[model samples]
Target: MEPIIIDGTAKTPTVKFDSTTGVMEIKGRSIPENSIEFYKPMVDWLDEYAKSSKDQTVVNVQLEYFNTSSSKCILDVFKKLEAINKGGSKVLINWYYEEDDEDMLEAGEDYESIIRVPFKMIEIVE
Candidate 1:
């Protein structure tokens, strides 16, 4: 399947979804003007990827900041991954945050509590 590679803008996050390695990485800020527009393609890509997914799918999310709209979009992405996990394949979400970013860590923990997939919170040291 074709991968989703979106370079980050001032208001958006960098998205790199590679089906070959089964690693979907999203980094940088995610406060886009239109969260649905910004995230729909990636969500659609996941729909396609789900058909022939790898045995293990890992999602790495590293965001410094994101607005409420973006947060919903992010949850949509995670929900898709949760479905994949429920389908018998393993799906892991790695939530990366700076060591001092308590809000980011809490956000990840929030998702972990709501989502079905396993999440690994990684603290990035500057």
Candidate 2:
């Protein structure tokens, strides 16, 4: 399967979904005007990847900020990964937040509580 790569913009996050390495990452801001439109492809790709994914999949999420819609879309992405995990592959989520950003840390914790996949909270020094 081909990889999914989207460049980040002022109002969107950079997305790198590598089918070869089983390493997916979304970084930067996520405040797109159309959150669903921006994230639909990613969710779709995850669905496809669920069929023959690697033994272990690693997801990295590092967001500076995101809107409410983007937050829901992000959850959708996680849900897809959860499904993949349920199917047998090991899925690990690495949630990165700046040490001083309590809000981001809380966001990661929130997602961790909602999703079944194991999550590692990584504190990044600024």
Each candidate: RMSD: 0.7, 0.7
lDDT of each: 0.94, 0.95
Model 2 scores a C-alpha lDDT of 0.95
lDDT string, candidate 2, 1-126, tens digits: 999999999999999999999999999999988899999999999999998999999999999999998999999999999999999689999999998999999999999999999999999996
Task: Specify the poorest-scoring 10-residue window by lDDT in model 1.
Answer: 80-89
Give the per-residue lDDT of model 1 (tens digit) for 41-114: 98999999989899999999999999999999999999999998988569999999999999999999999999
lDDT of 1: 0.94
Reference-based TM-score, model 2: 0.98
Question: Each model's TM-score, in the order given?
Answer: 0.97, 0.98
